[model samples]
Target chain A: MARRMLNQDLIEALTDNCAPIRPLPHPAWRALVWFAVSLCYVAIVVAAMGVRPDFVAKISDPQFATELAAAFLTSVVAAAGAFSAGCPARPAWERFAAGFFLLIWMGAFAVGCWRDVDAYGVSGLLSHSDIYCLPTILAISIPAAALILSMVKRGAPIAPFVTIGLAALASTALAEAALRLSFRQDPAVSVCIWQFGSVVLLTGIASLFGRALLHWTRRDALIASFQAHRR
Target chain B: MSELSDTSNDRESRWRALMASAQDGDHAAYRELLSDLFPVLRRFVLRKWPNAHDTEDVVQEILVSIHTVRQTYDRRRPFTPWLMTIAARRVADAARSRYARGANETTVDILPETFDGDGAKSEQETRDDREALRRAMAILPAGQRQAIELIKIQGLSLDEASQVTGKSIGSLKVGIHRAIKAMRQALERNG
Candidate 1:
């Protein structure tokens, strides 16, 4: 009887707490909005950093162009996947929608590395240390990550790890692409190991805080405030 | 089987309508919807985590979660799958947290027999300690005593004790804290 009364009290509190709310837009639509805004910010950052002197030449190269395009597509698709994961009842496959482009992006670098080995007898694969890649990607991704996190908090946090991981992937991948336009780093092996590695590392680290970042804060606040009101 | 499916379909549509109304800030509709969902969610939690310490608590949690994220529910889509998805995720989370809490605890069903073990009390000593504890508890204020009895002896959660005692959860926690301190002081004085 006490348990039932407690539930009844909870129900009454919840009902009193109810307010009209606008349903979230489709995940794909939200992803597009995020991508568009993020792209604009990235463009401004790239322009401010000054495009690499060899950027035009690099863009003209078929392999580099394909790799860059793959990265861009991966970011957009991953953004969609992140939003979809935040919503309940979305297909599980939506969580992996970006994997195809990610593989293609990785494959492009693998092909470059193989070509380097073939052309320069493994010497072409070597490059000077580029520790700067990690920090640069992290800096560029901060705004995108903040934007996506705020947008995603509006949805259900059923799959926080997946959602946050994908959001990280989306932002970091875009940041890496933006870095390619502004920083003239060479050797596909170096790019693959350092730049790509940084993206994965950042995503892994960000995902570890998923539950902390996305939780039932709203529900807890509502319950707390309602109970206080009753008291 | 068809009849069961039909019933489920009927339930789904009705719930969707109720949810839509609830989203419009219709208190009656929201109340009815939650009342309907509670039993179903309780059964769902039971099936998902049969070993759960308290199925109703988990159900209430899921309901709170649903209420929090109700804006994410698109009326254009079917409601059952969305509801079930959240329910399953919350069950998994509850199990994870339970395991985490269990990791810090050591459950002992029976104390091992000891021969003159260090710090082990004799029967007389144990009886004296129990008497001292009883006396300490007796001297505590009514609220403090009730708090210890409900939260410590009875092993009820603060929320549950709050509900039963009609005191706020914050007060219950404060009561428990003060009660323990008073008991410790009383015991020390007796010693």
Candidate 2:
């Protein structure tokens, strides 16, 4: 009968429009992991500085300064590894990871300077008297710079990378000032090596990590905004 | 107490009755309402489709959608236009699918122009005429079929069909005129 056929057709159509079954993933897990790892690293670095004032004193020697540069460069490499695992589709994950790396690197510089302030005196550390050792700082930073440049080329947002880089640079400048004030020493060749070398190393590490993980560059962000509007 | 107080309120009583039955999952009431409302939806789809086949398909799709989204529907609002909107969108989707499958293969064939003016034909003759129209419509090119559906069966105004089909009104008019002329010629030849 026509009535039966119509009823059958209506039943068939109704079943197709039921709500979809699959659940969407929660957005918080990626951010939480980045925060935990970065905070743990900050804790370890602070603890190490607290227990080892002798290690800070040894870093003033030229050989020790080179080793410190290599260690900082290694941290930059570690940051790149951290970034590789951190970047996800969500914006919250990217912003959290960026903030985490900024905090860890800045904390490391703070701890390092706080440990060495007694050997270098305030005026000796703060003044442009330490400008001669700029090359040593640039040398330490080379690896980090290379890393950041590679990341920038790949697609990270340049602004965040630049911001983290500037902050690290400022942290190094502050550390040098603290070292000179605490040590009561003039801005010597070793101070130049310590200050500039640390700045370059931190900047390079932050930039490289930024480049590898942050792919939602300005262009991608703009395109995503446009797509959201279209939707 | 409120129920006793509101017993004199006709609107509140009707709302309570409708909500209570609907929430109780009374599918029979839902189906009754749907069946009562089906003719308007069928007429809407018929405008989008020249033949009975697609008209039936679109009607089924709309009914399913209404049932699926029933939970979201506000009991206070009149449901007919909302139902029609879904029907119209489904019809448009069907039209787009037909269009994407390509435009040139199908062509509409009109029914014979020889029905008696006295309306004295037997029921069998009327059924036969409906069958012939269905068969003729099936043979049409997609564009011509859509044109005939929108202009003839659907009886949409030229401007309305133009907006639905995303074609200029002038082009739709020309297409419909050509399709009708072709169908008439085809029917005459078949006779």
Candidate 3:
């Protein structure tokens, strides 16, 4: 089929009317900045909430310390993955690394839960006093998730699922760490379900809306929309 | 291996220069880059979609995709792989959409004639049908939207749509029925 030549050169419609091209920072640099931003947000949340009096005592275990370190590392790795997804042809090893650390953290959380069960029986895991865990984890994820969404919008991501997933993962993982640290909650079956479940739940939700979340500001889309309005 | 790498390096450098100039608001450089890219991108798509006659559409889609994500391109990186990755994806997506669209009308449907937009309808009737279809489609689930679009509007055979979209023929058939039912309900409520 013969193609109709576009009346106005699309190049002119683009370069002449569109905003000036901005130089993209390296994906690693962008990821580092996102990591720092999320870290500062966590710091603020901790300062505002006030660290639990027993925080030092609870975090004393080598295993617990490793869990905290793993959480922080997961955020950093996942941030890298999120940023890298925006760039075409970039390696996604950062995302893979994030997944690896996430599994490790999951195992650590399970261990912590097992310890809690050992001391406090299976029924004791669902303490009425800890209902705040659900809301806190979800609330903490918001600002970080928003920041990631804003940053990722600056470029197109080939794997929208990976980009959105990593963004949700990085933000929620860090929040979980920050909340667990400052609030001093021992992992229990119910507590773990509410805290870590929030991240898994949000990530699953993000996958559904990934395509809509990252709208490509293509000139064609703009022009077609304009023509549609005129019609 | 060394020779191939060397040549690859050289091409990357040239493309990077073109992109840099384009980034600096050089229209000439931008035009040159796009013009140079078109054939290469077309060939790239054709390689994957060898039998696809409408490679032109795929080429245009690739260009739009490139333009959409142009800011994400790192000048320091080789441009070829990035371009090829997009080309490959666009071709695959187009093929998928086409594949899934091939089956809208199936044997289970009681009234096969309603949504097909046969020529017997007057201009006003056609307009009303289109309007109702549009509103119904906007509210349809994405899967249903795809089915209605490829099969209903584009008039692609279910088998053809299925080939591109990778959806089972039965699924597309069901989607069309669901879409038509929804549209009828919407039109009735509005009426």
Candidate 2, residues B9-93: lDDT per residue as tens digits?
6544444344334434655544445655577677878876766455665675566545433443334444444445556655665
Per-candidate DockQ values are 0.30, 0.03, 0.20
B1-191 per-residue lDDT for model 1 (tens digits) = 99999999999999999999999999999999999999999989988788898787788888888988999899999999999999998889889988998999999998787744535878887777778889999999998987887668656666656756779999988888999999999989988
Compute the DockQ of candidate 3: 0.20
Residue B35 shift from truth in candidate 1, angstroms: 0.8
- Per-residue alpha-carbon lDDT of candidate 3 for residues A58-174, written as tens digits (9 for 90 to 100): 678866787888888888888888888878888857557788888887888778777877887886566545566657777998899899889988867577887898888888888
Runs with alpha carbons beyond 4 Å of true place in candidate 1: A1-5, A218-221, A227-231, B108-191
The native-contact fraction of candidate 1 is 0.58
Superposed on all Cα atoms, model 2 deviates from the true structure by an RMSD in Å of 20.8
Backbone clashes, candidate 2: 32
Best model per lDDT: 1
By summed lDDT, the worst window of 10 consecutive residues in model 2 chain A runs over A216-225
Error of 2 at A6 (Å): 4.4
Error of 3 at B109 (Å): 18
Give the DockQ ranking, best first: 1, 3, 2
Q: Among these predicted structures, which one has the highest TM-score?
A: 1
Superior candidate under TM-score, 2 versus 3: 3
